[model samples]
Target: MKKWLLTTSAVVMMGSAIPIAWAGDGLWRHVPSTHAHSSARAVAGGPFAGHADVQHDWQLRSSVRVSRQVLREAYLASRAVYTEKLQKYAKVTPSQAKKAIAQAHPGMKVEDVQLRNIRTDLVYTGLAQDDEERYLVIVDAGNGKLLLDRLLPTHHERVFSGD
Candidate 1:
């Protein structure tokens, strides 16, 4: 009985230790890390500042490869264009576009609104309702004109069927 009890305890301890060792190894193994010792070797801007292939081997190992400042500058530039176009056109507010989309869809609700520049025209794209019931409502960015308002799947169906 004494020998059997000792062997059972040893087996249980081994099983628990196996899982604990695995958990500990996984905790640190998958975590993203960078080994950059200093900023002296950082990439300088020309045209390929954030290209994945241009990044160092150490940087490629980590999730992020591009400079945050570069991304911020691009975002600010796009926002400036969005603001300038909205103010200059004075055609439709996002709220107005939402209302128009809601009216057309009856029970559906507008989930998101985005301003897109297609050629010289500013278009408002509103995603309405859920994923399955979603509709893509495109309106003139400057005049509140409904250019294209169709169910998302219907649009895909037409394209796939070569309609």
Candidate 2:
């Protein structure tokens, strides 16, 4: 969810592929790329670049940390639920859930498909939209059971910057 670290050229190249940064259930929405700009200072080397091993060191240590963080964020509601172990257990993939959600919601556009934690089970959630209307559809990842199908507020488009 903390996508703010995305570099400028990377963000611009990504464009629409930018995921809708989520906050909490209804507290998330799409952040228009209009505000994503590159400052010269940001693009250029900083004063410490020549003096420190900052970039190289982080590049070396970040892989494991990044993977762990992403998995950790997946089950924010159930912090103890270590989601790195999810692949071995989840019967349903996000793509499968997306197809099912689209089939169920007809004209709804699937904005994002993410893993969420409800009670103790891993749940797959689909953030969807139809015109100006929004919807949230969830299914149990373990048994493929429908858990939640609800309409969200229409104007709930406040951009989340992972804060």
Candidate 3:
């Protein structure tokens, strides 16, 4: 055990000594750390500095940020198109849609009305809720006819079919 320990210590000493022979510094190599030194951060935020270094100054603008902006703009454009379709094709007003929901479900109160396209059909979808249950009622956008009145599940896995 003592021979093994001596041999291991000798190997470690030789391994450490090689770096000291190659480069004069035995303590640290030329590898940069993952994060900058705390002194650099202190100097950056210190009062003595003329220009304040914001967090964004050091943060990289990644493709994820670009994609998020692109997604937001695309959503806005799609919403504008939906709004145009609602104005052009929807003969029924929001009040009429709410009234349709009220007629079918006596106790349910219509909370919000939205224009949505289910595949190819444009409908006025309304979220209705009573004391215990919630429902989603759909009214035909073209002729003001009641299309679907279904109870929305409280918790369920949604399977979306996308193009």
Q: For every model in order, what is the number of clashing pairs?
A: 0, 0, 0
Please provide, for model 3 over 15-121, each residue's C-alpha lDDT reduced to its tens digit, 9 standing for 90 to 100. Answer: 55765754443223334334555347535655222222212122225463345575455555555555665667778777787888888888778877877778978
lDDT of 1 by residue, 1-163 (tens): 6465455455545745765764543422333325453223334542223432223322225464557685555555555555665655657887887778888788877876777667867778887776458778887867787889877675667688865
Candidate 2 clashes between residue pairs 3 or more apart in a chain or in different chains:
none
For candidate 2, write residues 1-163 as lDDT tens digits. 2343234324333532432321222123322223233223223654222322122212123343335565444435232233445645788887787887887788879867777677767888888787777889898887766778888854334444333
- Check candidate 1 and list the clashing pairs: none
Assess candidate 2 and give its TM-score to the true structure: 0.44
The regions of model 3 sitting more than 4 angstroms off are: 1-81, 156-163
lDDT of each: 0.62, 0.57, 0.64
> How many backbone clashes can be found in candidate 2?
0
TM-score of each: 0.46, 0.44, 0.47
Name the top lDDT candidate: 3
Which portions of model 2 show Cα errors greater than 4 Å?
Answer: 1-83, 156-163
